[model samples]
Target: MSIEVNNESGYAVDEAEFAALARHVLDAMHVHPQTDLAIMLVGTDVMSELHVQWMDEPGPTDVLSFPMDELRPGRPGDVTPAGLLGDVVLCPEVAARQARDAGHSTAEELLLLTTHGILHLLGYDHAEPEEEKEMFALQRQLLLTFLATR
Candidate 1:
């Protein structure tokens, strides 16, 4: 897989770690090895604009996903084909505040948000209660497993 991370949030972030987390999530989902992914960290103003434009929300959000190929998770034996997965946009400023409330480091919160965003790219959602349960469970599992390997 080809994962790229661009940090324009005006905050210092470990770009390599975001790439690694994305890779881990995609690999665990059996996505194609040649699939391309982009992770962008933007400022609150940019995020707020995107939120209103895309989601029609009013404020900045922690993360947003724009899927290019609309690829779904693949089984172990049937991996996804090579394609552009999508872009996972993150707001470090919002994540930092959420991190403080959640009692964790900004990096950890960003990692979780990154995982959540990638899952969205893979067609996972939490709009419904059942969907929320399943998605959150899988998100937690993926995040914990990835952290374990690190």
Candidate 2:
């Protein structure tokens, strides 16, 4: 698994552990070994800017996923070897707040966001009622299954 991670925040974040966890999550979802994923850990300032620029929101969010392509149901019978899954931008400050609210560690919160972002890259959307139910259900299921092994 080739994961290109960028920690833009000043906070001391765990790089190796998070990378391993991300790889584990993608592997659990049956992503290709060559699938390219990039993650950026940013501060609230950058997150706010991104939220406005990308999502047209005015505040920071815990996570944002920018998927390059609509994920199909399965790998094609004759598929190309190369794949770019796109990026997931995570804000540590927001994650910390959410962690406290959820009564979990910051790392755990980030893990949840990471998995959530991956699901988005896989064409999972929680916008509509049915979509929200299916997307969140799969997210919870994946998180539970992957975390149980660790």
lDDT of candidates 1 onward, in order: 0.96, 0.82
Deviating ranges (above 4 Å) for candidate 1: none
lDDT of 2 by residue, 90-120 (tens): 9999999999999999988988898899888
Clashes of each: 1, 0
The candidate scoring highest on TM-score is 1
Q: What shift in Å separates residue 106 of candidate 2 from its native position after superposition?
A: 1.3
TM-scores for all candidates: the values are 0.98, 0.88
Error of 2 at 50 (Å): 0.6
Clashes of 1: 1
Sliding window of 10 residues with minimal summed lDDT for model 2: 72-81
Model 1 score (lDDT): 0.96
